[model samples]
Target: MYRLTTHSAIAEIPAEHWNRLADPDTPFLHHAFLDAMERHGCVGESLGWLPHHLALRDGDDRILAVAPAYLKFNSYGEFVFDWSWADAYRRHGRAYYPKLIVASPYTPATGPRILTGATPQRRDIARVLIQGAVQVAEKLGVSSLHWLFTADDETDWLAEQGSMRRLGCQFHWRNPGYGSFDDFLGAFTAAKRKQIKRERRRVAENGIRIRRVRGDAVTESEWAIFHRLYRDTFDKRGGLPTLTLPFFQDIGERMGRNLLLVLAYHDRNIVAAAFNLIGERSLYGRHWGCFQDFHSLHFDACYYQGLEYCIEQGLTRFEPGAQGEHKVSRGFLPTATWSAHWIANADFRQAIARFLDTETRDMQDYLAEMNTHSPYRADALPDRIQAVS
Candidate 1:
């Protein structure tokens, strides 16, 4: 027998125990990462990310499965677009806020939402976690339950659990055993490769030097400067930032090597920085901010720097956040991303199902179109690199 329980914080579960169920490749789902988000006021009931963590325990109180979850009031930090769905609900006089979401908050990178150990019974444990989530949603009377940016293997299970599958696209760069950034460029078309070279050269000609700082090597003062630039970007867009300065500081301490910054300096002064999180096999470019904009500093500090780091570090993949059609030209190719949803109300469920059906077709067509404009040389691309979806 298993008991399903919910806690208001990730700290409720021991990090050692929680990490045991987490996907080793996804550092974003680690206990310290989620706890840092909560302890530093980045996410909480007040901030609209009320932690509602789920766990499945056996008769002897051994944890068998866990889900990093939240009671979300609005979809601000979530990269998966669902604002229009909320509008649809409101138009029909239905409440959409305070819904249940199982995800790495604000992270669009794909991994498991329901984490299970390496036991042979892992499939059964996953089933229990999903069923428990549905029961909790019904008991709480929420309108919907969402699992965002889930890994591909979880899709069939989620669909079997009565969730509608949705397809989205994000640009990602895959390593093809390149020994250097130049080798990476060699695979691209001559025109595109020249364009990339010009972008990097322009940043250098503008008197900017970029450095990669990892973890504590980044001083408290520099982190402050980074956050100021970070907030400045949000201020320009009239947006709110979910992660706070203390939050970044805390993760920098806890995650150590997993945290890094691609910092850009102009005239010996800090002008911009791109914050990235590292995993065993991937580098995730999550945040970027600049005190001032230069001709091509963003591409240099964000995309090019990350690609270089991935090759140098022997990482297999680089995900540069969500929804950047512009990233396609810079050697980041179109990659399919997935999310799943369970709508409670039947009528609304049908409406969303119809919408997703159409959206999926549009997304597939768009991905195909984007591929036709692929930046890599037609003959240079490996089949695995070109055929990813």
Candidate 2:
């Protein structure tokens, strides 16, 4: 028999046990990453993201599956926006806060929401985990449960359990065994290829030098500089900078090798940086900040540099964070991202279901239209456009 458990903090679970089930393709799912957030106060009741992680274990207390989850009081860091849903609840005189969410806070990358390792009974374990999460929602009397930025397969499982599947789009670059950056660009049309070249050259012409530094190789001073850039950017934009210097320092110490920082230097002074996490077969870009704007520096540090590193390292894909239609014109292709929701109120659930039906159709149309704007030559386009399932 299997039993479900919930912990108020990730530290309640052993890193080895949790990581054994976690996918290496998503560093954000790492126990160390979640633990650091709790340790540094990046997530808590004050930040409106309270850790309420889920774990499934056998009779002997051996963990079979795990999920990074939160009792969300407000939808702040979750990149899958649902502010309208919250407003709808308010309009109906219902509460939406204190909902349960299964996601990596502040991250929008898709991976396993339920981390079930190579167990022969993986499907059964995942089903139990999902049921357990919904049960928790019931016990807490929350409005709903959400599985955000989930893997395609997990979305199917959640939908089978009657969760409303929602489709979204993100721009990503795929590596098709390109020998070099130039080789990768060769797949693009001549005009598009030249456009990319011009952007790269503009950065160089502006005397901005970008260096890809592995996390382990980054000095303490460099981390401080990067943190300042990150925090300042958030401040300037009137957004809360929740991730702290200590949090970055902690992750750098625990999982440094998985980190990649693209630092842009102008006249020997660091001006901008892109924070990325390396995965088994992907490069996941998380954060970027700059003190001063340089010509095409964002493109170089955020997109092109990531693409080049993926090519050089033989990584298969580059997911440079979320939602940028502008990326379509610069070699990144529109790809489907999935999320699933379980609503507690029957009437609201039906309304949401109907809304999702229409939204899904609109999303399909959006993806098809976006595909028409592919930068690659007609014969060389990426063949991985996934329709909403």
Provide the TM-score for each candidate, comma-separated. Answer: 0.98, 0.98
Which numbered prediction scores highest in lDDT against the true structure? 2
**Per-residue C-alpha lDDT of model 1 across residues 1-389, encoded as one tens digit per residue:** 98999999898899999999987778899899999999988898787899999999999999999999899999978888899999999998989998999998889998778899677887788888899999999999999999999878677788998999999999888897999999999998999999999999999998999999997688998899999989988999999887899998888888868987989998888999999989889999999999888998999999999999999999999999998889999988889998999999999999999999999999999998888778898899857768756
**In model 2, which runs have C-alpha deviations exceeding 4 angstroms?**
385-389
lDDT of 2 by residue, 200-285 (tens): 99999999888999998899999999999999889889999999999999999999989999999999999999999999999999
Taken over the whole model, the C-alpha lDDT of each candidate is 0.90, 0.91
On the 0 to 100 scale, the lDDT of residue 167 in model 1 is 96
Q: Alpha-carbon error at 8 in model 2, in Å?
A: 0.4
Error of 2 at 27 (Å): 0.5
